[model samples]
Target chain A: MKPAMLYKLVILIGILITGVADAAAHTIIVHPSLKVKNISQALQQAHNGDTILVKQGRYAVANLGIDKSVTLLGEGYPVLDGQMKGDVLIVNVNHVIIKGFHICNTNKGSLRNYAGIRCESVKNIIIENNRFNNTLFPVYLPKTSHSVVRNNVINGSSHENTTAMESGSGIYLWYASDILVDGNSVSGQRDGIYFEFSNGCTVSNNRCKNNYRYGLHFMFSDSNTYIKNIFSDNGAGVAVMYSGHIIMLQNRFEYNWGPAAYGLLLKEINDSRISDNIFGHNTTGIYMESCSRNQFSGNNFNMNGWALNILSDCTGNRFDHNNFTGNTFDVSTNGSPEQNSFDANYWDKYAGYDLNKDGIGDIPYYPVSLYSKIVENIPYAITLFRSFVVSLLDKAERAIPSLIPVSVIDHHPLMQQYRKS
Target chain B: MLKIAKYTVYDIARNKIILSYAIFLLVISLSLFMLDNDPSRSLSSLMSVMLIVIPLVGIIFSTIFIYNNSEFIELLVAQPVKRSYILLADYLGVAGSLSLAYLIGMALPVTIYAPGTTGLYLIVTGIALTFIFTSIAFFCAVISRDKARGIGMALLLWFFFSVVYDGLLMGFLFLFNDYPLEKPVLFFTMFNPIDLARITVMMKMDIAALMGYTGAVYRDFFGTSIGMVFTLILLAIWAVIPLIIAVQIFRKKDL
Candidate 1:
């Protein structure tokens, strides 16, 4: 090749490479005061990988749909009003980014899919730093995958509005996968974070309080990780049902008290890990039914009505290295001869001392008693929990190990408390 | 009366303030609609617009429209026409013009973008809110002797309807948390026009999940044919009550 031609070819290759790189990452600015008259037109004109930056102003428009890989950003509280028509914003594309906008006043129609921001079948989307105010539903993801929803403030104050007919949620994911919801403050809605039929998701570092419904509710969502989240003053702290391979770690479940309140309620869950969580001031700390092979460790059960309520059919579970302190009832199990093991836990009511200084109790502790077993079957018997007859019967049952499960005793119980810090 | 209505519409069309508002709305609405690719996403964006801009235009335009049109009102009163005619004409004129402006500015973009019942509902809501606020401004103008006080009252009314009413309802719920007043709560919500508007539009949108159980009860009660009638009746009251009060005050006023 000629020397000049070779140099030109090299330059052409460099230009092509740069063009490809630029196509992968593009930037678009939406001036706060640019005052564009049509949002649809602007979106239609935008390229697949471009970013739309919206400045601080009220943008009154109708339903917006996202179908391409793009980033939409709002600066200084740019408002997106739905005019009470339908779902405000819907995302149908992959790798899209939405941040920093006040989204509100969504219309709650009987046929509408999601109210605030609905993502359908999209993947690898990021929604962050946004404020959803007075919307019916804040962030809804259906059949989407690999999405990160973080650092968002979702407020749904439907206190006096009778016009809203649907249940509102701060972040609702259904049939989604590989989702991560973290560091969000959600209040005054139905469910703060709800997952149904979702798998392989992580919910962590989120503050979900004062919601009318559950703080974190999952049904048939398997292989999910929940860590370091706070669920306080909601109708229920957390509910896990028909799920497996779930990990619940370092979370705090508090102040979820009502006629039917629980810190954590597990129904038909199997092969899960529940560890390092703090449960306080709930009606029941952990209510389990038909859950098998789940390991419970290093958790603090404090000031709950029943620290552990293991119903019949819950088998092969392990409770170890946990601290049960100041709970109204340590453990209540239905039926005889439980299949689960309770070991190495620090019980506030432990009578045996660790004379050998091995950090393990000398005597095996029977967490379940005949009185508790009776109360489990006839719940009204709980009113006589502190009565002399019940205490005497409980002591007798613990010493004898007759009606309750023989294997339910905490062998090698911890003499010293296990604290997360 | 018809001439006054026509002039009011023409004057608002020519007014620089309204023109700016129309342009601003056009720009923002268009940007929001175009930038969003999902219809549902745009619905949320439009909701933010409605909550902020609807009350803003309703209060600001109505206040200024009343204040600036004081001379025109006085001139009309000086003529031999009925005071009721003058007030009605003024109301129709201002409301019609602003509604027209709102329609042209917002309706066009919404129709082009969504082109569904939702867009049409929004246009109707915007127009309804404009008329409702105009009537409220007339009432304020008739009651207050000073223009400043009148504007102040109008703004306060807007604030109450938009923000404070919801707050007060929450306070009530908190105070009476022990009592189950779900049915009564539905009845109570009907008194606020903003709540009425929210309910009416939401039912149309089919996203009742946002409403919760109480909202569902209300929907069941009011989403029926009878409920539709009741809603229309309430909306009529929203229009008629303020106009009637304004007319009554205008008829006897010394001005």
Candidate 2:
């Protein structure tokens, strides 16, 4: 036979085998008020590639261990109460899907192992459309890969008497990779979504609000894409620490106000891309500390206390094609000889003209004033920020561009405002 | 006084609402223990939930308990029993019952799942909150003539203890972020019940590294036996001061 005919024969055989396997797949229905005494038993009876339908009922089962490649679907909020026995559900199998269940009441253990649903060392898992209500550690993925967690609602209404020192994340991913968390709602937890030592993940289209701590917190996680998410009313917004190759795009960060709160906090991070994001009503729009080689473009920084707070040790970062309007301060820098560049941005404070009609201002706009640098070293100097002496000094510094770094000025700033709506 | 205390305990113990609350807590605590993959993670989750829920339940349950028993209190006051004894009995009875319920609801689950100093710390915190909120509820009852006002006062007290007190402390820290006010702030934070709870749990967990400079300062001063004793004393004061004030007000207030 010819080579093409041999390839066609191989494909035909593969299709037939897969067709037979698909026919063998089973469907198990767990109806509301089903009198199944043991959830584990229901899971045990399910076959590989089976679908277990759990329909609206309260299942007070603790530790429903799932070790099979099966789909568990819940209809109308089937409640799984752990009763503090251990993790509510432990998924230890590949290609397992858990969807649409209200999980609550995770037990407080000493070793920090309690979770509403724990995926340990699993692959190709899908956890979607679930509700973790009043749970301690709601959804924990440790040492897992290629998982998707989507459209889930995780709420942690922690009380003083019941709380333990180690217990509070809504969704925690540690040492995991290639995961996608999308379209979820998390609130009132210590950290809404925590990523530690995880890499190559995507977090998009999620709403995290009113969390006790950070809405999205990552430490030592790299090559992650966070896009189109809404983070609001949290203690702090998205915090990227000690990571690299991060892409933050089109995300809405607002109302994360406190002493050290910020819309996006970059600490010891490098080589990231942050573009097309909306940051408003936060204590600080973007705070960079010890970060380098990052690019920020097409972002809207509005109504924030400080549009950008660049601490010492940040270098080679570029801010261009962004809109900075209605902010208390356009930029606050700590160190002199700023290594970063701010060009082509639309600043509301800019008074420069486009005399040539080239859409670029004739004169450069200095973002970091001498007064801002003084306030960085001595914050109390902020008290005299609007004083005549400080104003004269700022004017002198702008005219000469001596005290502040020359590169920090937006040389080709846009004459017209860029409205991001 | 002892008879009244016994009667209050019996009434709380027999109430279906308290029973359901205890049962609900049991279910939740047990589920939490079962759900967590590691024991330490579960402990932290429990601690977080306890921080918010315990104070809410303590204040609400005590306030409602006091208000609901107003008729019974009037009946007892009509007898020869002194109001002071009656008030003390009511406070003790309410505190004891709530603490007992918490023990059954939360403490047993922590012990079974967490099983360490952290669990013991959680139990102590639960008991402390029960006593503190019970005292605060009695104070509210003594100060306010109307039930709605009394309940509102209890809720405000809860709000102050839970959220506003922390906000004020944070504001002070931000205002004085440049200063080295760690030692004085440590003493100041001890006055707030929520801060005390936070400090106690942080001390037990040995996870002070997460709290930044504040934890470092706390570990520096409060890592010793002297610090522990001071914290315990402050916690004791937190429970006692409100009770003493409530007793004083109850002695003077007309029924």
Off by over 4 Å in 2: A1-23, A31-37, A158-166, A385-389, A419-421, B1-255
**Candidate 2 residues B17-103, lDDT tens each?**
777767877988888778655565566557666777777777788878888898898888889988889889998898888888888
Show where candidate 1 strays beyond 4 Å: A1-28, A31-35, A161-165, A385-393, A400-403, A419-421, B1-255
User: What TM-score quantifies how close candidate 2 is to the native fold?
Assistant: 0.59
Cα error, residue A340 of model 1, in Å, equals 0.4
Alpha-carbon shift of residue A92 in model 2 (angstroms): 0.9
Tens-place lDDT per residue, model 1, A379-407, is 42332333333456667777777787776
lDDT of each: 0.77, 0.79
lDDT of 2 by residue, A194-218 (tens): 9999999999999999887789899
TM-score of chain A of 2: 0.90
Interface RMSD, all models, one decimal each? 18.9, 14.8
